[model samples]
Target: MIDYTSPIQTTFELQRRSLEQSQQALEQSVDIGQQISESLLAGLDSQEQFQRRLVELNRDTVASALDAIESLPGADVAVDDLRENIDDGYERLLDGHEEAFDNISAELEDGTDSYDDLTAELLETVEEQLDLLVEAHEELEAQSVEAVDELAGQVEELQDQAEDVQAQIEQVSEDAARAVEA
Candidate 1:
């Protein structure tokens, strides 16, 4: 009456589902790695734009400084002021680029660390599932042993009943022979 197939099916489904989930997690990790790599390589900062802006500013300052100096030879204060402003702007531009590079580097490092952590967590989860599977297998083996023991007991009982029936037949034959003789 016990449909033993049910437990086998249940175990099989559990294993199947666990494997599926593990596979999905692996794929997701791979995707995350790819995205991170792309993001790192894509140059996600305004450093290049800032450099271009600095170049334009320097060109404009040089043109204006030259014009001011050429216009008045006696006194040219605008040229010196323009040069100083241009130098300051260039220094600030360099500093901004350095800061941008540092920021981007830090972001990439953080992303890499996070990816590693995610992968490690996924692997740990899979390991835990495998451990559970091993425990389930051991439990099934124990149940099988119990079932075999029960079957053996039933077989032994059947054998004893067969022997008792054979003895009763032999005794009935002996009684019939005695009756015929009487």
Candidate 2:
């Protein structure tokens, strides 16, 4: 006799394997996203550090120039002019530094926001897929139970029919024996 449950069992196994693969892929995607975010933050931190070092170097150079100007003999007017120029340069440098800092701050904030949005979207997609898988599994389970119940009923009917056929065969054998004796 053919095993009727084999096909159903194979189908369920295939679906289970597919679901496992999908879950693994989702996990990998989340890991990759986290790595990318970490890399971006690290790069931003390095850039900020470089900018600070550059500002410090520029300040030291300005101070050194002012000391050199002060040491020169018979150059009072030149010293005054040099001081004014240094003041103006320092002011401009500070303003530029502030502007660059603001721009970087805004860019970093925007990057963080974008990362958060992407993460939220990915999570939502994963949740939806999981829900669908769960629904499919529940439906399959219900169908399997219904099929088994139907098969059981058919088996019971076949057993009753076999018993009736056996009774008829016994009656015929008894009649033949009586005829022979007569």
Candidate 3:
């Protein structure tokens, strides 16, 4: 008996692997963007204008990443449900940052000696967040790059196998035609 399931099974397996790899790559890219934002924020020296701009850019990037993930072909479920959480988190974080900036501005206008302390605290917080962001960004960048390379190799392999199979089929068909004419 012919093993009729082999070819279809192989094709399905390839497709499934491709999908998994693609999803992983997408997630990794988002993580890298988040990290970059954090690192950039950390480097700022407590300048109010700098902080405000960083916050805006980070929030926008996070929102865009969430949107991309949400629109994936098979994003119905996730390991951490990160897609849903990310958008809301970015929005809240941005709002909080803005509010903090406003408070700092008010303090500056009130001729209080508290601006130094407040700036110090804000700088510390930014530093901590930036450290985390940098780490996450590096890790994600490696993962995404590896995943993409692996997926490309797998696709090339699958294409070669398909072409081989096609050639065999054509050769068999030609032989059959020759035999029929004899």
Candidate 4:
């Protein structure tokens, strides 16, 4: 009739809530980390665009300046060489940006997967341990109930024995009265 395992049940409920909160926090943190990564990549992308535009502007300015001095010997070859070098620099910058993005993205993905896996395992372990505690508590309660039943049976048997002795005493008293009358 009494819920002896109420405390354990309450503890389990509280632990479950705490675990759920932990899981939620982990998820939120992962999302925030991902957002940060995306922001960083976007910033880098914007910078790359800006740098490419700057290189283009420089190339055009140099070309226009050379055109103004086209009467000079080798002016055209000098303009072409300057443009090629600027183009090469831009290409290298682009490659570096791509490499950095790939590295960061890969690392973030791997880290996320590891964190998720660790969280799942931790939660599962806690649940399993909690279940075992409940199971053990239930067994203990069952044993207590059995012991109480056994004790009650013993007390009832003692009472029955006492009543039998009382009946014998009365019979003996009557026999003595009859003997005294004779």
Candidate 5:
């Protein structure tokens, strides 16, 4: 008996793992953002630290963003590959089921006495394979949806952070202008 479920199961597992990794990456990004904000606020007491921290923050932020952008293509490729694997699995499952049914029908037409036993066994196998495929598909779909939602939330958060940073920079500029005028 050919085990058709293993490949699908492995694909789902790989996708789930990838999702987990992405979530971890997002968390790390958030952590870095928080650290940058904290560093900016903390150095306000000292001119040297304030200037140094700002430089460091800019460098870190740019580096982090570049790292993220670079990783995106690989992530996209993984997702595309996963989708292709899923499509292939579905096609193979359907083809196998169809072939099994055709074979059983042909045997029945020939008035084979063993057709009943063969059909029953084939039906059971098909049902099991179908169930596995459906379950895997549902799991993969749910995971993908959840990952997308989380990523959207992360993007929104990063946007908010950017806005906050911009506001801070503007305030600093205004303060410097006032001091210069005085």
Candidate 6:
């Protein structure tokens, strides 16, 4: 006969191990999900700010270029008028950049504030529920202890009653024996 059963068993075992490994990996991912969320939220505002800073650096580079142009040796053209227009344009561009950065910062601050508020509210609710759960558990434990103690006391009373009844029966039997002899 072919060893089909042995191969099937081996295949099943391999599949079982594979499933267990996958389950463990999934469990580990679930465990870290919260940490990942927290980390991303923590970085959210800062990441945007960093990007804004990098973008603003272009302002400095542009200013340096204008400064070099202003320092250029006497040109054949009307440098003052040319410089004036360039400076005006630079001023407008700088204002726009500053305004944009300010607006973005304010928005980020508002968003982060709201996010923090919501997270805090969520945490408070969870904590309250946990406290209630603990209180309920404690009450249940106390009730259980009381019930067990009451049951034990009843059992002891029943045992004492049984022994008393047994003693009475022995006494009655002795009395009967004495009566018969008399």
- The model with the greatest lDDT is 2
Q: Give the candidate number with the greatest TM-score.
A: 2
Decide which is better by TM-score, 2 or 3: 2
Candidate 4 all-Cα RMSD: 7.6
Query: Candidate 3 regions off by >4 Å?
Result: 1-112
**Candidate 3 global lDDT:** 0.64
* 68-126 per-residue lDDT for model 6 (tens digits): 77677774255567667766876786678667767766776676566667766765665
Q: Write the per-residue lDDT of candidate 3 for residues 100-154, one digit (tens) a residue.
A: 8677555544433343345446556655665576566556655665666677677
lDDT of 2 by residue, 92-180 (tens): 98788768877876787688678778877877887788779868886886689579767977887887788888888888889988989
Clashing pairs in 1: none
Clashing pairs in 6: none
- CA-lDDT, candidates in order: 0.72, 0.77, 0.64, 0.69, 0.62, 0.65
- The best-first sequence of candidates by lDDT reads 2, 1, 4, 6, 3, 5
lDDT by residue (tens digit), candidate 4, 95-154: 786687668667766776676677667667756776686577657666666766677677
The list of candidate 1 runs beyond 4 A from truth reads 1-14, 26-30, 37-41, 45-77, 134-182
Q: Considering summed lDDT, which 10 consecutive residues are worst modelled in model 1? A: 1-10
lDDT tens per residue, model 1, 39-76: 76455545556666777677677767677775887556
Q: Quote the lDDT for 48 in model 4.
A: 61
